[model samples]
Target chain A: MKYGIAYFPSKQIQDEVNSYRKRYDSHYALIPPHLTLKESFTADDAEIESLIPELKKIANETDPFNITINKVSSFAPISNTIYLKINPSPELQTLFDKLHSGKFSDDADHPFVPHITLAQDLVDQEYSDVFGSLKMKKYDLGDEVDRFQLLYQLDNGSWTVYETFVFGKEFV
Target chain B: MKYGIAYFPSKQIQDEVNSYRKRYDSHYALIPPHLTLKESFTADDAEIESLIPELKKIANETDPFNITINKVSSFAPISNTIYLKINPSPELQTLFDKLHSGKFSDDADHPFVPHITLAQDLVDQEYSDVFGSLKMKKYDLGDEVDRFQLLYQLDNGSWTVYETFVFGKEFV
Candidate 1:
């Protein structure tokens, strides 16, 4: 069977107020659209399902929060993995910590590090050589945080979004 | 099945090495250490078999080329597509041209925008923000072109090298 992500989830935060989208009937649990990345893996779906209860529990006692996607980083400090890093505000951190520590209900839960994976293991001399020579330049604009999505794997081994929810903000 | 890559036959040239590795007593055509990335996905055995001949043909006659992974790049340019862009080298451009123009065996083809994907796709923001902020600081580190590989898909669907073949420096 193809894997899937269920329920609402958060990965990054948005900057603009309008970016937030909601899940459930409550307007408080919203997601930032700008932070929403594309598609997801089966592994992601499973993990999110396992974390719902704990996340709700935290949100109950905690004040609403905001998250910000801050910088980009490299895995080997040079080679291999590369991705974007998120920095949630303090209130967001409390929720993140609760979710991360007991994030997934799975028996084999993944340790949450709060970063979005841009690419994983890419190594081939011909491929890497071409990759290695690249000189990436950066440009940031007035961007905002959006909602996070729950992703799933389809029968064709493709990933799709199961759902999206906002945090700390209400949507139109 | 476990996804993997195999380098086979010989690296002297693509067409010249095509049938060598599968010849009994040619175990040398394999990648022993099984180069792996930290967050790699696994694929089933049978699924990966299909891509072999295709990768082999690519290794052969692909030509001696230099490419510029000149900088760290994100897909969608403004957004993330979970891949890095490589500046196709002139020699490699010759290959891309040949492939795009149907110069290679007409059946063996692809629109050649030579690039090695850094990550499969940005699903979870595990590191998207961090990776996004990274600007590939350009620097040249001369390394020899060794061999190319034929990768396989594991049950989990991540790719690994199943076979490989080396190229002689005099291949040109």
Candidate 2:
């Protein structure tokens, strides 16, 4: 099965993002609004089962951190994906590095750029038109993320939760 | 620093437990309602940081599981811990075993008992009085848990979140 790791924002943030996504995003229904932490990778059941203990330790060491979205941005030239740009934090970078290290494989096509996609897979005309107006609008939103989910894609191309991990110390 | 692993239930469950905890549990204000997965262990910052990658692998392999609390129970001779009993599940057992195995230490004072403490640290007279009444009332509460937290204790005796691991796969 194919799985990916991501941070799902609070419902308030999801609702706000959906308002724009409903009109512009082709993948609005495929999954909920989220910030991708690790890009998707392939693994079988046994391969994944063996990795759970290590994942718990990663979560144990990670402290929950805040991400602020002050502006809308786009992956132009590279792709027509427009997103709510998450302000970078050291904690986020550390998590990205951990996911790509050790037993896990690192096969990222792009360098880590923290974001929650609001609109994606658009034609060039729509992309330009949407990105033009949306970039000017203000979006000062933020949330403390304590957990990230492991997700798998369904036969219908929709995604569902496979597991979740919260950021914090477990020794107490 | 002293650290431990635990599962914190939903707000509704927390509130319900707190209703009893406020009056009975001496350590109520020290922390919220939780199910302890790994008992306390000592580790410095560097030692904990080194374990993050392995923790991530653990969270990746596990799947989100459910716990049901249909009755009130207590740890009488073991200790004066009054709790809402969580019926045993294979997933819980598997997780407990993983936390105890490999890089982590296993120094459990008691065998694994899945529960959320509603009351603790009571005198014998108080313990009997409380358990007698609370045990009679039914509590058919349940929640789907996808994540667990690592916590550390503060100087003032309260515990704070250090990290959290949600059970799931990361490869997609």
Summed backbone clashes in each candidate are 88, 49
Residues A1-172, candidate 2: write the lDDT tens digits: 7788888776567777878887888876566678898888888879887665666678878888888889999998888999999998889999998989888888877789999898888999999999999999998898998877776654445454555665553321
Best-performing candidate as measured by DockQ? 2
Q: Lowest-scoring 10 consecutive residues by lDDT in candidate 1 chain A?
A: A23-32
List, residue by residue over A4-39, the lDDT tens digit for candidate 1.
222222211221211211211121221112222222
Report the alpha-carbon TM-score of model 1 versus the true structure: 0.29
Q: Tell how far residue A17 is off in model 1, in angstroms.
A: 22
Model 2 per-residue lDDT at B34:
81
Q: Rate the local accuracy (lDDT) of all candidates.
A: 0.34, 0.78
In model 2, which regions exceed 4 Å deviation? A1-172, B169-172
What is the lDDT for A156 in model 1?
Answer: 26
